[model samples]
Target chain A: MEQIIDKYRGDSTAMIAILHDLNAAFRYLPREALEIVSDRLSVPLSYLYSAATFYRSFDLEPCGEHEIQVCLGTACHVRGSERILDALSRRLGIKPGETTADGKFTLKRVNCLGACALGPLVSIDQKHHGHLTIHQAERLLEAYKDEHD
Target chain B: MMIEVKINGKPAEVPAGTTILAAARSCGVNIPTLCHHEALEPFGACRLCLVAIDDAGRQSIVAACNYPLEHSGLVVETGTSAVWQARKMSLKLLLARCPGVKVLQDLAREWAVDTKDLLLTEDRGEECILCGRCVRVCREVIGKSAISFAFRGVERRVSAPFDQEPDACLGCTACAFVCPTGAVKVIEQNGRRLIAPWHSNLEQVACKECGRAVAPLKMLAHLRGLAGEENEQAGEGVFCSRCRRLKTAAAVTALPEVKFPGPFMIP
Candidate 1:
């Protein structure tokens, strides 16, 4: 596979931009891919590690295939959002930012999605679900239960 | 072969696969860190370790710990004003809730953050630093997802799967140690809850007056509820409801006591 170095072509100005795009797209810059870029452009490994670790958007770990992001925003508190989150935590048997024992689900929490209307929202992948009571959430999570697949 | 990065407009030779954070560390450039720990994998959830990367053709803040060195020639800026402000503000917000913990206060002092805005908004309850390290360690290292992150945003916490007290926790302090905020405190209270992961442990503090062991707080209230002014006068420290009622009745009524012994009578 070709390294993502063609985009940079020794142009340090363009190199950072390309890496950012790759990371934003994948949420984690592939280690091999990064090595290829570093080799082609002659950038130091220390710099790359530094850049990766210093930023908030990058992830050295693989992104969760199925992301369960709970909103812990301020408005969500007044709405008893903790109950919804707690219920999800129970049903999944994993806390936020953790994948299940089976590796099928990865739970995480975000501060705010700016979706105050959907206080206490839990989004699976890209699908957003909100306004969850424990009862409501149990029904919603039935989709993840074991099935004869 | 090595890659070249422009540091403050100077091209520098570096080894392959170096993140900006790693590079800065090697170069003795101090990039402030709060959530990033050397002993653990990169968890970008903190948002404090932001560095400007000239990637995607524009500069945006990305966590250096997780963002990789996928390019050779990138413009990176650390310790910028915007980055410091974001970290300071985040620390302030975290400190406002968990003032009981001293680490947050120390961090605030180190950063010289004296903001009244963070003080303006305070919420009651346990403070969770939201580092995700404890939650991650509890699962990844300990193999028991005994305690995990609950809630979202600032309201988030590292807790049992259901916030019902872990029915599976081995009473291990793994989660507690990695926790930047001491939000999750595990006391060796005996088996009282519906379910606990570990062996049943509970404390039964009884009523101080009746010697009846109830919950410690419950005993205090019960003693208060039964305490009468007469009990205060006699100074035996209040009695239970049954004893208090009997004492009050004994005091109110002129009891017909068939005296057995009197100092004034000769046997």
Candidate 2:
């Protein structure tokens, strides 16, 4: 945390960058970590929390080891992305914003990935698996599960 | 330097960089506003102050509260049909959000806005218009940003960090005082000040002379710190407003009077 604050030279304007680094390191923002950042930067904790909540990228809760982001953008939705999301939710036994009980996978729905041509897109651990079918997505999840086991 | 601008075809000269709302008010033109406060910075959050502007035949609608009068000969129409339509739409949306608020209802009736055709989801019975006055006053004026707007979209609201009791709140009630919609409430009970919407409970500091409950202890400490005083003795010589006034009057009566040579008349 001190390194991250020092990296930004303790500049208040680098709040977003510092938060991003913290998120990357911890996979989510811990409440105590945010307090330390606020104290070190002399920025208000409420302000930092406001920014963290406003942006979708920052997760307040601990994320699962594997992240699965399904695009719910206009083009993707038109191509039956919601159906894919529902299928995954049932298979994983967790909703879009929830992490699995074993903390293996966290499912999220993103607005866009800027890749409209690949409608019904899904990204697993930042690796894009576009033009996916429900069966293929299940198989992909199975691969990660096998690797973990 | 002053710049000339015509508001609703009435010529008015206002200083440079003045907001259109201020310029209109200076010329006796009234622009209805809910989120505007003279003490705070212009936060164009509420869209109720929209007005039509025609600068050299280029026309556009802008919020009068924050839109500055940068150029001369800018024609501002406060009561144009477009302006009324915009304001009515804004009110209609606000009514849908806060159906129980009387101020929004009155504004809707005055503007003749019919929300009959407007379909609303569940009535949340919420009064906060998200005007951000309390947030701005706490951050800008009081210099303590104990509360802030959290979340986004329809789920957005003013809250303390993590929706927990605010750690930094002074219980100053400045947020409650500045809230236009009376959304923030300060309740005093059992010698404690409870700032609602954040649920911060602070012990009230008593006046040293009379032992009456004064301001909140944390708020007094904050003020004393602002005054560049050490906080070791938090309760020493502190007096409430009434006690302080009486003390000043008594001290004035006890002072010896001295005659001045010249008449103290201002030129």
Candidate 3:
């Protein structure tokens, strides 16, 4: 954490970048870590929390080992991405934005991935899997689950 | 430099960069506003102060609080039908969101806005019209970015850090003092002050002279820090405003008198 703050030279303007680094390191912003950032940067905790919550990328809670983000953007929605998301949710036994009880997979509904051509897109562990059907998505989840086993 | 503008057919001269709202008010023209406060910057959140501006024949509707007068001889119509319709729509929307807020209700009554046709959502029984007054006051005036608007769109709300008790709140109640809808509630009881909206409960400091609750100890300390080291002794004693004034008066009266020459007589 000190290294992250040191990386930004504790500049207050690099707050978002610092938070991004912290998120990448810890997968979510821990309260203690945020407090350290606040103290080191001389920025208020409320302001940090506000920024953390405002951005869709930052996670406040501990995320799962595998993150599955389903695009719900205009093009993806028209191509029936909600059905894929619903299938994934049912199979994972967790709603969108929730991690599985085993902490293996976190299902997230994202607005866009900026790859509109790849309608009904899903990304797993930062790897985009586009033009998917429900069966293929479930199979992909099963593969990740098998890897966990 | 002063600029001349006509508001509702009445000529008014105001300083350059003065907002249409301020200029109209100086000339005895009333433009209704909700989110505007004299001390803070214009937020234009409520859209209640909408007015029609005819700038050299180009017509535009603007919120008067933040719209500065950039040019002279601009014609502003505060009571035009278009302005009235815009204000009425804004009121209707505000009423739908905060059905129980008396200020909105009164405005609706005066504007003859009928709530019968409003597409009502599930009433959250909320009075906070999201005017951003409390949030702005705490950030801009108090200089403690202790609380802020979190989330976006329908989920947006003024909240402390993680919705927990704000660690940096001074318990000054400045947020409550500036809130138009009485949404930010501050209650003092059992030697503690509770700022309800932010879930901040702070121990109140008692005055040294009369033992009255002065303010939150943290707030006094913050003020003392702001006052600097030279005024440390002055800031050490926790005295309410009334007691401080009385003490100053007593100190002034106890000063030694000195003889001086008579005014206009050198002898």
Candidate 4:
């Protein structure tokens, strides 16, 4: 933690990247890391969380090893993404924001993954499945349904 | 004029077309605003992203994303006293008639907008933050001016040719995707039922008589394609409320008027 502070000593401008780095390294940013970040960079903790929550990329919750992110963004919305998302949700037996009861899969909805060309995109643990149909989205989830269990 | 920006007090070269919003964010200064999205054009409508720049010239409240930078030996306060007050009030006004949204809830919490004791205003039924992200993305990115901002001031909203259905949209969910709230929807039939994520609850159809799940939209749409009823729709969802009442009256009126004061108590 002291090293984290020393790396950004008086260089308050490197706060966003520093927080991002901490988040990447620790998965979800630990509260202690945030406290250290606040104390060292001289930013309020509330302000930091506020900043983190503003952007759609950051996550405060613990993610499962096999993370499943559905593109509930609008372009996909018009392209029959609900069926795909519903299939994914039903196959996983979980809602959009919950990890499976088994903890092997975590499902979440991102505003847009910026892959509009591939309407109804789903990323399973960072591996993006593009141009997903309800058939395709379900097939992808079907593979994961038992792998973790 | 090249502006000298001490990002966290370390000087960096910033030229013109630099909105104060982009400059501060690049320098580890985080100013949160609702209407600011990198994918769309700058909508300075939401005044939450204000930054204070103290220089030799006239200093004032500037929207970072829209305000251009000039040659000035400057001191920029990312969260100054005046900036915070103005931002908080702007947030409150925006939330006054908030559509009771979770995304807005998260943003509201971050900007420290008061939740308690603040009066709630009428909802637009559509939770369009008026960010213009949808309109800009559709026009600029999608290159379809099928939808544009209609009306002005607080009454402004993104609408189709005449707020009917989008003639310009390719049935693409671009606007729906960019919408901060789930208002616009694209519906399609899967087997017999209607499925779309634009609404929280799905329009389900049960038998008007037996209460059995009878995919009404599909049944009606299919029946509507028939010869004489080319317009006469079938299924429970097709008939207008009053039309159905009149038709039911005409059908059952000739029969014995069955009247029973009924509360069936299961024993």
Kindly list the per-residue Cα lDDT of model 1 for residues B1-267, writing each as its tens digit: 587776545566678777677777776677766677766777887666777777547788778778767668787777778877877776676677666567777877888998566666555655666777866775677555555554444445455533344434544455556666665555533423222322223334433457543333322343444574332333235355666677789787866767766477655
Q: Please, what is the whole-model Cα lDDT of each candidate in the order they appear? A: 0.62, 0.90, 0.90, 0.66
In terms of TM-score, the best-performing candidate is: 2
For each candidate in turn, give its C-alpha RMSD to the true structure in angstroms.
23.5, 3.5, 4.0, 25.4
Q: Which stretches of candidate 3 lie over 4 Å from their true place?
A: B1-4, B208-211, B229-267
DockQ of each two-chain model: 0.02, 0.85, 0.76, 0.01
Model 4 over residues B1-267: C-alpha lDDT tens digits? 667765446576777568777877776777887677788878897777877776766577777778777766766777777888887777776666564766767777876777675554666554566777766776677665545565444555555533344323444456666766654564544323321322212233455544444444433444455445653444445444555677789888789877877987787
lDDT of 4 by residue, A35-127 (tens): 678668776454455455555455566666777888878988788777777887888888887777767887887878888888878888778
lDDT of 2 at A25: 94
User: How many pairs collide in each candidate, listed in order?
Assistant: 60, 0, 0, 3
Give the runs in model 2 whose Cα sits over 4 Å from its true position.
B118-121, B244-267
TM-score of chain A, model number 2:
0.93
The weakest ten consecutive residues by lDDT in model 3 chain B span B227-236
TM-score of each: 0.44, 0.92, 0.88, 0.44
DockQ of 2: 0.85
- lDDT string, candidate 3, B30-102, tens digits: 9999999999999999999999999999999999999999879899999989999999999988888888889
True contacts kept of each: 0.00, 0.90, 0.90, 0.00
Candidate 3 lDDT over residue span A48-78, tens digit each = 9989988877899999998999999999999
- Tell me the spans in candidate 1 whose CA falls farther than 4 Å from its real position: A1-149, B7-17, B123-125, B153-155, B186-267
